[model samples]
Target: MDYIGWAWLFVIVVCIVIEATTMGLTTIWFGIGAIVAWITSGLGFRLEVQIFVFLVVSILCLVLTRPIAVKKLKIGKIRTNADSIIGECVKVITTINNINNEGTVKARGQIWSARSFNDEVIEKDEIVCVKEITGVRLIVERKK
Candidate 1:
């Protein structure tokens, strides 16, 4: 085995091991691509062409099929309900008025101080949707 072939093999093996550790399949495609490069190296391709093949295939796998990994891999939060209210629907317990950003909302059955995405206070009994969360404050918008 020549230096080019050895290098390609090494690259493939390392990528595969990393892919195993993460199991997201993000780098497994790269590993497969590297194996392709390794096979090409054994077929008398120059180091430059092998490297090019390695790079092109790796990038193609990453860019083209990245959505597969994105869809299969769920990198969501496993935290408590408090952090989960960011996307929940809630009813305002206090009005969100101008000037002062003071309001409350019942989110997931828990009352929390809610702030408008505009930083305004929401009025009581108003329905709002949680857009996102910031610390203990909820960034909400009027339901309508």
Candidate 2:
């Protein structure tokens, strides 16, 4: 009905579009806030009051619901095949020398370039545990 109402409508549309594209449970709260502000503007509320309501409502929605929404939606990082090898024991097929940058290990029937996690030299035929994967190389530490 007014310029403030139009602005709130625009904010609502933009927030909705962003939420739709990301699906990350963000921006939806701001859309809700904008809707409230739009209604406030339609009710002849002052611009300052409308803005304050928008901010408070948006922050309250985000703080009160985001964690619960994230938990219920099970939104979290998805592990990959490489992540599964972390903490797995593997046999070093070649000497691991961080200085020389030469090493190999066999894991799950696959040979992967390996490196010592702490830059220590690990002799060939030693048992090591996979610590992390960087690019095509596996960072390992000698098994106790």
Candidate 2 residue runs with Cα over 4 Å from true position: 91-94, 99-102, 109-113, 117-119, 123-127, 131-137, 142-144
Looking at model 1, report the run of 10 residues with the lowest lDDT sum. Answer: 74-83
RMSD in Å for all candidates? 5.1, 3.2
- How many residue pairs clash in all the candidates, one count each? 9, 0
* Highest lDDT scorer: 2
lDDT at residue 53 of model 2 (Cα atoms): 96
Q: Per-residue lDDT of 2-113 in model 2, one digit per residue for the tens?
A: 8889999999999999999998988999999999999999999999999999999999999999999998887665556888999999999999999998999999999999
Candidate 1 lDDT over residue span 48-117, tens digit each: 8988988898889888887776666653324566666666778988886546767888876778877888
Q: Which portions of model 1 show Cα errors greater than 4 Å? A: 22-25, 72-98, 109-111, 116-144
As a whole number from 0 to 100, the lDDT of residue 100 in candidate 1 is 75
TM-scores of all models? 0.56, 0.73
lDDT over C-alpha atoms for residue 144 of model 1: 77
The whole-model lDDT of each prediction reads 0.80, 0.95
